[model samples]
Target: MTKNFNDLVADLSEIEGGYAGHVPPEWLQGRTAYGGLSAGLALAAAQKAMPDLPPLRSAQVAFVGPIAGDIRIAVDPIRRGRTASFIGSDISFEKDGEWPMGLRTTFVCMGERESSIDHVSHDYPDVPPPDIGKATSRGQALSFLQHFEFADIKGNPNQGPADYLRWIRVAERDGLDPMVELMLIGDALPPAAMKLVEGFGPISSITWIANVLTTTPETDDGWWLLRSRSDYARHGASSQVMSVWNTRGEQVLTGMQGVALFL
Candidate 1:
């Protein structure tokens, strides 16, 4: 049976186990699964296999191959411990006499482990939200953003180079597990933003890694502020640091992404 975009998104957000897949629309311009879709599916599979664990605090996914249409995903439970569980999965497209594109992900569950903290120091950007009139649909901004909602804070639109504040969160999915929601939100920041800072140029990420801070938000309702900045670009490589916070003014998670420039 064919499924609508909403239904597929709903399935991805759910807590149930088993394969979760989506057929990208022609408009997406990809014959295979979107990168974010694969990442979210891998996260969901990991979550479903370890439902008793705490919320997923971190996930590092490597896009080893391209996922064609009609993808099939399988989950493997690595370890389930008292305070945390480790899980991983592979997403492959089904085809006759062909290899499928795949991705592998590891999820870490948060627990009550104690730790010592050092001094805290990080400056938050001060910028007003983009006028609602200028707000654009995710489809208007980027093909993948179509599945998400974004509110630009810095209102910087120069394609040459820029950095802006924004609020991002996914539309609700029925039976959506909070962990899946968090993972989707965690993966939404685009690498294109880094290009803005490094001057216009073609860039591709060979691998993306996100480390979830221990103090991530506990709820999904609030608008999380994402402060993204480009720190370095050289030798056909670039990197960006992203800091996420809940609407209540609390630090959630900080992410760093490394990019490989094609040009």
Candidate 2:
């Protein structure tokens, strides 16, 4: 059954030790849930568990195991100070017989403060605005990718340079929180280094580190520019640096991801 992003999150239940949730069959990436969805839920749970937290500033996600059928998420407050809050989250699911780790995360939230320093080292691509009329399904993406639409896409998976640039957005983003929305759409692209692969193969996102530039960042019709490039790929792994920009050309989130490729 097809469901919106919000619906999947609403399916979560706050249990005793943690929260329980379910993923629709279509959202599965290989044997696990989409990296974005699973990670989004963990962040959502943390927001629900503690409403007093400030805007999200940074986050670290470890895709430790696959998450299908059912999910368990637990969030603990590592510290809560005057302006910044640090919280950790753990997501788990049962496999054949044992409970394996699904996702482990740490989120940092901090309010805006008066500062003489404010800058971004990354540059927004010189591409024109996303061709709204050209947004369409590539049809070659994973099952969960059907939930999104891409435009102004650049880069060929069969070619080199190892990068993908596109404007992407959720089909249904009404009523969704900004941070939560960003969390789900941030990792929408495939691993950058995969561009050099000749064929599709097993790929796992091992870790993700994200730095939020603005919690109030917004884009036209929910579209965000996603730019990712892999400067290094070796043996059986790849590391990518990414940046998300809103329609206003504002940097929303800067992220780094590690992927394990079995190609």
TM-score winner: 2
Q: What is the per-residue lDDT of model 1 for residues 30-51, given as tens digits with 9 covering 90 to 100? A: 3435555666677766655556
List of clashing residue pairs for candidate 1: 66-101, 161-196, 162-196
TM-score of each: 0.76, 0.93
Tens digit of lDDT per residue, candidate 2, span 107-172?
999988989997766577755556667555533444887788788555434324788888888877
lDDT of 1 at 111: 65
RMSD of each: 4.5, 2.5
